[model samples]
Target: MEARVEVSPEQEARRIAAVRRYDILDTPPDGAFDRIAALAARLFDVPVATVTIVDTDRVWFKAAYGLAGVTQVGRDPGLSTSAILTDGPLVVPDTLQDPLARDHTLVTGETRARFYAAAPIVTRDGHRLGTVDVMDTRPRRTTPEQAGALADLAALVMDELELRLTALRMLRVERELVVVEHAARERAERDRAEIAAYAATLQRTLLPPALPEVPGLEAACHYTTASVRDVGGDFYDVFPLGTGRWAFFLGDVSGRGAPAAALTSLIRYTLRSTALLQPDPCAVLRALNAALLSESADGSRFCTLIFGTLVPHPAGGFAITLTGGGHLPAYRLHPARRDGPSQALARAEPVSLPGGMLVGALRQADFTSRPVRLLPGQALFLYSDGLIEARTSRGARFGEESLAAHLTHHAATNRALGAAAIIDDLTVLLDSFAAGPADDVALLALSAATATPTTAPSGASGTAHTSLPLPARHSM
Candidate 1:
């Protein structure tokens, strides 16, 4: 018969203190610990497995497998409480035959647990707080390898607890600093203005200062924020690929403030670097999806984006292939066919892209690309959801149909309107809104530069230039 182990009064008090120090009891279930418990059950071929913390009055189950709806039991007759009384693994081949556990409530009551094994979850300083245990209804014996594996699992749980404790401590320190800063700042207005300025500066760093000049292609972009106090998620960029091709993208991240800005920077870097190696629009986006999924395993961050490549066509202007990832549809504006000297505007055509699923939402998401050609006097316009979802002065949503009609009107009235002119007109419209745009607005336009302007519109200058100011807050 094996001798029973006893813990001193001081030792038991230290163990309870260790459990409280971890701050893990009564907390929400953790995925990592649950997985460990499930794995332990499978390894020992037992019907029940649990990671438990032995408390003063109860044995609390942090993670349980095959023990449904049972959160805790009285400390005295609990298997976990007995397991923690020893310094090493306690394996009872048959509960009915073991002198120490034979009269335990778990064995004499409805549980009828015949076989049991557990490794004490001991901290680095030799304080046993809990156990990693498995129970079976039938008598069984475990090999040395199985017992050692159980100990390893207990060590893993301790490591996880230590990591969680470190994270909690850091969060508490950050909260304390925030409290001190709040108390120090006496003027609310000064704090508000400083935060807005900082947000604006950070947002500008996420985008290119000026659109790159693509040969034979005129590009212009403008950004308008709905509120200066809040950091918006809209971003866009155009860059050359060095292979006689150019790449551009416009998108909105899923959040605001520092997290959104960080995500925006990561997305831009991933897209640019991935496109250099594999320039296919769909493939590049796939790489980005993989990067995002790997970085954010919880799927907390995502974006709606349109990625495209522009190549100089031998026949005329440029050939553009675009792929959408759950983003708004882009519009193509055609110049009126001239039977004589009179010029008019053609209706806008919405690009229909099939199989474009939300990126970073799933591992097997599909993105499709569509090819379009840009002729002279034709332009491709891309804008974020803020444009259409914005509320007009009349309190009605400025929907897609209304936006299309407005674009057609401007194209017809302004004969010299190119990429820059189009963006300028939209910026003015956004500023005129009574409430300004309810969200951040980003406008990107690419047009084939015409050789000569037939007639300059009323507000038109000599010719529309792609050069525009850097991203600045346009909302009043």
Candidate 2:
């Protein structure tokens, strides 16, 4: 059988009143909360007191007097959220004044609570946490001195609230700094990737993808930049004009990267165009100088180049006319024969490429030309300063001699194969002599063969008739 539970009238009223105590919940805590709780207990000389943070159904004490893990606050007694209201101090003038007092097991008849007071706990921003509450078994009031002391204690609680709020702000600022640092790092990585990509495109633009063909002439060329970094200023080109004549050029700008690359491009197109219009090697060089000077802004940028023409040599070889504009002397390697080891052939000195100056440096420059018969089984070479001046291990230059010896050894090889070998050997030699070549290297080689018929002696034609007549007379 189920026992019947019955609720008493007075007991029910007190329970309803207890539930409407304080209203605060889900809020940040403050030092002010603890101070207020402690002050209330001391001022009233009570054994139980608290600054409670109220939730929907229960209240948690942020600070308490005479309490330990006393979280089951009020035991369905008074919920704290209701306490935050009531602007003035809630002073239980006397527990006896309570209608249902006798039913409030803690008060009413036994241990009759005659004293109580609660000051609402205030936050720095003025939001309430709960209440500073105190309770006693006897009714009492204090003098002015007592009241003043209580006020001082409450002020300390406010300070505590301010201190806790300040700490929260500091934590927020530190987190923001971490976020900012991460964003900056990502931006840096993206920038580096972009620059690397741009460098690749720039390299492709500066050099031709393949060599242009010229009839009667076999040609091979090699080019490389110091690195695929910024744009560089060196370039080389060979092309056929509408006429049978072929044009070839190699140039070096004073610097490297974008500015240098730009100039190199201008030179490449300009040289090719000028050669097509005027196949004269000297005139082409002169036009390039004038064009560069005309277009330049600061006038500080300039280029050194060698331009040349390809034509058939009457003696059964190709006669190449080369014009130099303060450029590195080109070399020619003849096959080793009665001559000792193969040796270098440029001219006694720089063939004066008059009327040509470094393109941008001066408006009126002069270039001069020299012709060398590149016979069958012989090779012609043109290179940039980046090769000879390449620093060696001891800080000395690789110079003209080392290049000549390599050319002599390899010049008889196929045009493509020979150029590659020369470059590779020079590269290794560079590492041996210096750490490595400090600059970009550009090299061009041309080879050709022409067939010729054997001829009889020049004086034989006049003597033939007299010899036949003398022989006939002797026979008669």
Candidate 3:
């Protein structure tokens, strides 16, 4: 007769906590887990098999095979309760012959479970949540191979649980963000600065609050809104894709206000999710184009964007791949190599996409992706057309040539042209405009700094530095 092992109160509390953390106790039936349970029954040659979660007072069946009309059983009568008490697979070749398990309700009662085998569903931290268990009417021994397979199935269940938990956490964060937006709307209704507050709040929601710190790279961004009363559709972000790869995008949606803001959110979400599935720059843009077109009722909705990926180069720099979608040319600023006595001035060159067309504008739009290497002291600059389209105090269009000339001049004068330096110079230029820019402008600069500043400061690079308080119509 095998002696029964009792779990301590402290141990039981911790085990129950591990089960609750998954948030899977009463979740609706999942086909993935159901298939796992069904496979277990067939593989083990048992009359019943279940993916059970041992709760405080009962064993809840996440998935059950051959257990019709049974969803849960009391913890005292549940064989899973004892199975979870151990760290390894528990096998009862004959319940009637084992004194410890013969008195279990499932064996002596109507269930008539004479044979039982279960693999403990252990978590990473060593807590056993429940079991992948099988029961039979006739007593039978389990082969070593079958026992090993049962353990493998338990692992698969844990992986699925981890995936679900991650998704749930993200959803909760999104819900919290929505709540904040709602509160901002309520404040707008009660204040005279309604338009300004509302537009600023909505605009912030459409973009990342700060850029992430990419090793061996310096990044900075700034945004300027033309009007406090109207929300602009410009957005940009930089994010990691794991395994030393990163993705970045900057774009502008047509029109302004509520509709444009909504579209901007959709575009950001689609790009991020699609990038994970397919990291290729061209494929990611195609997915975005398809998504935009699908939501367009009359095919009139459109946007301009540049999406790209950055991979760390083996030779101490980054390999960049950029694809344009009917967007203005981005510039690559190359520092003058000091190989000669007369150092040449820094140069700004356009990175034009030969065949790229407007995204979401045409069904058969083709995007062109070009690869470039960002070496030491070199920077990649991206901007919305807003800067080139803006008018000066004399009412002259800024134009692409003038903008390029301005950047080239700035690059020549500064010895160390980091991302922050480039963006700060442009920010001063925006401030020089008498009435500010005519449209919203977004700027992103990435550089491979040769020295200094171990980590890019969040205050300077992560957050968007904005020039917003324009004199339009101030209620309060």
Pick by TM-score: which candidate is best?
3
Error of 1 at 262 (Å): 0.7
Q: Local distance difference test, per candidate? A: 0.78, 0.56, 0.80
lDDT computed for candidate 3 = 0.80
- CA lDDT, candidate 3, residue 423: 94
Error of 3 at 19 (Å): 16
TM-scores of all predicted structures: 0.57, 0.49, 0.62
Which scores higher on TM-score, 1 or 2?
1
User: How many steric overlaps does candidate 2 have?
Assistant: 31
* Segments in model 1 whose C-alpha atoms lie over 4 Å from true places: 1-186, 340-345, 453-476
Model 2 residue 464 lDDT score: 5
Off by over 4 Å in 2: 1-189, 338-356, 393-395, 409-434, 450-476
lDDT by residue (124-183, candidate 3, tens digit) is: 998888899999999998877778778877876886676567656655665566566667
Q: On residues 353-390, what C-alpha lDDT tens digit does candidate 2 reach at each position?
A: 55555656766666778887777655567778767877
Candidate 2: 10-residue stretch with minimal lDDT: 460-469
Candidate 3 residue runs with Cα over 4 Å from true position: 1-192, 340-343, 451-463, 472-476
C-alpha-based local distance difference test score of model 2: 0.56
CA lDDT, candidate 3, residue 333:
92
List clashing residue pairs in candidate 3: 210-462
- The better candidate by TM-score, 1 or 3, is 3
Q: Could you tell me the lDDT of residue 208 within candidate 2? A: 61
